[model samples]
Target chain A: MKLFRMLRRHIRDAFKSVFRNFSLSVASITCITITLIIVGLSIIASLNLKNFTTEIEEDVTMIVFLDADTTEEQISTLTVEINSIPNVEEVKFKSKNTSKNEMMQESDFFKETMSTWGEGDNPLKDSFQVKVKDIEKIADTAEEIRDMDKVSVVNYGEEMVNNLISAFSMIQKVAIIMVVALIVVTIFLIINTIKLTIFSRKREISIMRLVGASNVSIKIPFLIEGLILGFIGSIIPIVVIIYGYTALYNHLGGVVYSNLITLIQPEPFVYIASLIILGIGMLVGMVGSAGAVRKYLKV
Target chain B: MDLIRINNVKKQYKNGVTAINNLNLSIKKGDFVFIIGGSGSGKSTLIKMLYREEKPTLGEIIVGGVNVAKLRNRKVYVLRRKLGIVFQDYRLLPKQNVYENVAFALEIIGAKKEEIRRKTLKAIEMVGLKSKIHNYPDQLSGGEQQRVAIARAIVNNPKLLICDEPTGNLDPERSKEIMDILEAINKEMGTTIIMATHDKDIVNRMKKRVVALKDGRLVKDVEKGGYCSEAI
Candidate 1:
């Protein structure tokens, strides 16, 4: 019961002090707010970038072109050989006629030119569309298929795809490192901000100690003040995340530049991201206050 | 009947200055004792040791039956709860009013709301600051601020009241007013009072038990005496 009363008083004192030292409190809150907003935006961008990369990775398919004179039996054997590879996920054969028809449908120019070619004089090659279960081993799988009989060429945009994947991975790594560094910087900034607040009230704290306040009792109010500041600081960032992300998603039509680079749907994604921002803000705020108070307690 | 017993206490600063060296003193309950000394004569160090503010370098200090010299820093607040301390600067929270300032002592120690109200008002009234209970420290005179400090000190009803030059900042008239409140608390509640001061006039006028220190040694102890300039 006595503990409950003390906690109540600590909370009251924290709120009173936050307002009593309004400028200092504002400085702390502003510091948290600005840092958390950057953090939130970075998280949103990194996750969306990851989503886009994964989508593109899944869409990658290797095309194996066969010789125009290859027999149906040889094609069947080649399909079997390709499917036996450990990385080969799926294989589908496309006849020359079907390929020609697809090209015709893609454009009026192809339709106009292709209609003049007789069936016997057609020059399109039959091919197998291949998908691999593991993107990392796609090169090995492509090599194995190329050595097969009657195979003329194998193409999956190897260099461009490899470069794209590696570049995306590097970007993701840099994004994560940037976010971590920002959080670390925020913690230090918040600690110094709260230290200033405590320094201003050194006289008040000395009086409290002389009056017999325990270390825990003396620290409780400052900790609560940090928590309150962090909570308030996170509010604007949360608002920005929930509304800003959805608006950006809507304005961009859920994709950036093309369908391969898509944004994450904002339904639960925004909510989850908002929660993360809130957690970071509160945790950093409390840690900063605790650090400042610990230093003062030592003195 | 001894409320505080210092057995050969010694305090040496980190700079190699021995503030109190092999000093012994004791005060009975309800006694008004004055510790008089020149600057740097170990009077402040001796009083600070009583509340566990400055741990003695060598010796035992027992206040209210607890040995404060060996008390841990984590448990210092426990020892302090049994004593009240007033400083030369009054040390009242500048933002708090007289009533809140007095109540703050009890509030921090987790006293109940009703009990805090009763005791805080009683302590404030005892210091004769009932009319200025709502006044802030800046709004009050130097004497009134010192009275509030006294009220805060005694609000917890500590067994010992320690004052380190409580009236050093006040004029003669205001110093007398502050002294009157301290005297009332000592007589009415039987709280042992230990005060360190440089004011020879107040020391001589009070005619209380005077303990004089010189160069970290207790030089003179009198039953009812005036301030002495040196060892006698």
Candidate 2:
């Protein structure tokens, strides 16, 4: 009962000080808000980039064209051989007639030109669209398929795919670095702000010390004040992150063209991001106030 | 019984200045003792040493049977809890009302709500500021502020009340009222009062036990002494 009363008093004093020093408290909250906003944006950017990269990885497929003169038996055998490759996930065979028909249905110019050609005059070659389990091994799998019998040409946009992978990986690294740097800067700013608040109340602290207030009693109010500031600071940023991400996702109409690149769905992603922001705000506030109050508590 | 015992206590500052040198003194329980000394004569240092604010460089200061010099930082609050200290500057929290300022002393020590209300009101009444309890420190005169400081210092009913020039900023009439309160507390409640002061008139008028210091050494101690050795 005594401990509960003391905690109540400490919490009351914490709120009282925050209200009494309104300007300083606002400044602290502002610093935390801005810092968390930057952190939130960085997180969102990293998440989107991650999703886009995964889309790219899944979209990469090796197109293996067979020799035009290959017989049906040879085409079937080649299909089985291609499917047996280590990293090949699935091999889809496209007959020349089917390919020609798809081309004729896709465009009016192709239909006009292809209507005069018979099945025997079809110029399209039979090909296999090979999807791979892993993007990194796609190039090696394509290379292996190139040396196979009846294989005429292999194309998976090798250079473009590698460049895209590297670019996304670099973005991921940079995003991590940016988020870490922002957190460090936020902690420094929050600590200094809390130090100022503690400085203004140094007289009160000394008076309490002389009056026999224990160190824990003296520290509890400031700790609570810090937590309140951090909590208030995170609210705006979390709202902004959720709102801004939803808006961006809607504005983009979809992920990227071809439906491969996509934004993380708003529901669970925003909820998780909000949790992260709240956690960072509270943790930073605790650490900053704890560090600042330690020196002045020597009395 | 001796409530405070100082055995060959010596205090040297970090700058190599010796504030109290080879000082030895003792005060009995319920005794109203006046520490009379000029500026820089180590009157403040002696009072500070009693509260464990400044540790003696040489010897032990046993207050209520606890060695203050050997006490750790964490235990200092425990020792201070048993004592009340009033300063010359009247260190009242400017933002707190008179009532809250007095109650703050009790609040910090985890006193019960009813006990705090009862004791805080009682202390404020003793200081003769019952009507002005709602006023802030800035709204009060220097004497009234000092009274609030006194009320705060005594609110916890400390075993020993140490006042360092408590009436230094007040006029003669205000000083008399403050002294009268302290005297009443000493005589009526038998709380040990050790006051450091330069107010010769109040000291001479009170005719209490006086301990005088000169250049960090105890030069005079007398029973029923006046402001100066020759005056009595």
Candidate 3:
């Protein structure tokens, strides 16, 4: 019961100090809010970029064309050879007939041009549809398959996919670096501001110590004050993340330019992001306040 | 019984000035003692050491059975809680009113609300500042502020009270009022007091136990004596 009363008093004192030093508290809150907003934006961008990269990775497939006169036994041998290559995930044979039929279904131009050809006179080449376990090593797997005898051509839109992957990876790295740096700056900013706030009250703290207040009792109020500042600071940024992200997603039609580069769904994503912002705000506030009190207050 | 025992205590500052050197003294329980000395005489340093503010370079100081000379900073609060301290400057929180200021000491030690209110009021009444309980520190005169400081010190019912120039900032009339309160607390409640001061007239008039210091050494100690110029 006595411990509970002490906690209550500490909380009350913290609240009173927050208002008593209104300008200093506001400065700290503003710093937290601004940094959290940028951090939130960076997090959202990085996560969405990651989603786009994964979607594109899943869609990448290597198509290997075979010699036109390959025998059934030779085709079976070729399938086994391709499967044995490192990183080869799955292989499916597409007969020239199936390719021709797929082309016909795609447009009337292919249908008109190919309908006159008989089964023996078909000029289309058979191909193997291949997938790899690791997209990073897809080029090596494709090179191995292309060097095999009787292989005509291997194409997986290599240049475009590689370029896109490199670009997205760079952006993701920069976003993460930005988020981490901003949090660090916020921590230092809070420490300095809280130091100023407590400097004026150093005498009060000494008097408290002289009157026999324990170190923990002296620290509790400042810590709680930091928590309150952090809590208030996070509210605006959280609102921005929830509302701004959903609005942007809606404005861009849930995708940036194409279906492959899409935004995360708003339901759980924004809520989770808001929770992260709140957590960061409170944690940073507490840490910064603790640092200030420990270094400056002496008690 | 001796409530405080100082044996071969020595305090040398980092700058190489020895504030106290190989000094020993003892005070009994419920004794009202005066530590009389002039400037740079090591009286303040001695009082500061008693509160563990300035640790002794060597030796042991046993206060209320606790060895304060070697006590750690983290545990200093335990020793301070058993004692009341008053300063010449009257270190009251400017923002806190007289009642809150007095009640703060009890609140820090986790005293119950009812006990705090009763004891805080009683301490203030003892200092004759019951009428100024609602006024802030800035609103009160120096004597009233010192009374508030006194009330805060005694609120926890500390067995030992240490005063360092408690009447230094006040006029003769105000100083007399403070001395009267101190005497009443000592006689009525039997609280041991060790006060450091330079007020020769007050010291001479009180006729209490006087311990004099000069150049970091104890020059004289006498029971029921006046402030002596020969000792210096």
Candidate 4:
């Protein structure tokens, strides 16, 4: 019962101080909200970037045109050999007839021009479409398969794939640096704001200390004040993240750049992002106030 | 047994300023003792040492059987819990009213709600500020504010009351009134009172036990002494 009463008093004092220094509280909340908004936007951008990169990686397929003089038995043996590669996930055979039929269905000119050509006269090459498990190892796997006999030429957009991988890696690095810098700045701002709040009431704290108030009693209220500030600060950013992300998703209609890039759906992504922002806000507030209060608690 | 025993206590500040040097003193329980010294004579340092605010550099200060110099940081608050210290500035929370100010002492120690209310009112009444219970510190006179401070200091009914120039800011009349409240608390409750002061008139008039200091050393101690030996 005594412990409960003490907790109640600490909470009461925390809230009282929060309003007692209203301007400082608002400034702290604003700092946290702005920092969290930046953090939230970065998270959303990074998540979508990760999704887009994965889609590009999955679409990377190596097409291996068979040698024109290779027999059907040799072609089948080559397909089995290609599937045996460690990094190769799937190998699908596309016969010349099947390729011609797909082209005729896809284009009106192919349909008009290919209707007079019989299967015996088809100019299309029989190829094997090879998908790799790891996009980073795709180049090595394609090289290995290209050296195999009966393989005429292999194309997996080698230069374009290399550029995309390097660009994505660079974006990841920049995003990480940005997130860390923002968090550090947020912590510094919170510490200064809380230091000011504690400075304003330093007299009261000294009096309490002289009266035999324990260190825990002196610090708990300030910790609670920080927590309340953090909680309030997170609310605005959470709302903004949800509303902004959903609106962006709707405005872009899921895909960008002729269906080449896609945004993550708002279902679990927004919820997770909101949770992360709230967590960061609370953590920064707690840590900042704790650091500020430690210096004045020498009594 | 002595309520407080200081054995060859030495206090040197970080800047090499010796606040108190080779000081030895003892006070019995329920004794109202005056610590009389001029400016920079270590009167404040002695009173602060009694409450464990500033530890002696070289000796042991045993208060109520506890060696304060050896007490750890976490246990310092426990020692302070048994001591009620009043300052010259009347360190009452400016925003808190008389009742709240007195009650704050009990609140910090986690006293029960009913116990806090009863004792707070009793302390306020003892200081003759029951009428000003709801008035804030800024709204009260200097004397009244000091009374509220006294009330807050004694709300927990500590075994020892240390006052460092409690009436330094008040006029002679107001200082006497505050002194009267301290005397009443000492006589009625047997709470040991160690007061540091520079007021010669009150020290001469009260005729209490007086300990005098000069150059951080105890120059004189007399039973029923005045502010100075010549005055006695």
| TM-score, cand. 4 | 0.94
Query: Model 3 chain A, poorest ten-residue lDDT window?
Result: A290-299
Chain A TM-score of prediction number 4: 0.91
Q: Count the backbone clashes (under 3 Å) in each candidate.
A: 0, 0, 0, 0
Q: Candidate 2, residues B108-177: lDDT per residue as tens digits? A: 8888999999999999999999999999999999999999988998888888999999989889999999
| A26-112 per-residue lDDT for model 1 (tens digits) | 998998889889889988988887788777877899999999899999988998899899899899999999999999999999999
lDDT for each residue of candidate 4 in B1-232, tens digit (9 for 90 to 100): 8999999999999999999999889999999999988888898888888877788899989998889998877677888888888899999887678898889989988999999999999999999998888888999999999898888888888889999998899999999899999999999988999999988899889899999998798988999998774322
List of clashing residue pairs for candidate 1: none
- Docking tier of model 4: it is medium
Model 4: colliding residue pairs: none
Which has the greatest TM-score? 4
lDDT, residue A175, model 4: 75
Error of 1 at A260 (Å): 4.4
lDDT of 2 by residue, A47-144 (tens): 88778887778878889998889999998888788777778888898888888899999999999999998978888889989999988777789889
Candidate 3 residue-wise lDDT, A1-299, digit = tens = 99999999999989988897788788888888988888888888888877777777877889999998888988999999999987998999999999999999999999999999999999999999998888878888999999998999999998987886688678778877877787677677766766777777778888888888888898888899989998999999999999999999999999987777888998899999999989988887887787777764343
- Give Cα-based local distance difference scores for all models: 0.88, 0.88, 0.89, 0.87
Measured against the true structure, the TM-scores of the candidates, in listed sequence, are 0.92, 0.90, 0.90, 0.94
Of 1 and 2, which scores higher on TM-score? 1
Q: Candidate 2 — number of clashing residue pairs?
A: 0
Q: List runs of model 2 lying over 4 Å from the truth.
A: A66-97, A108-126, A132-134, A144-153, A251-263, B229-232
**Alpha-carbon deviation at A28 in model 3, angstroms:** 2.0
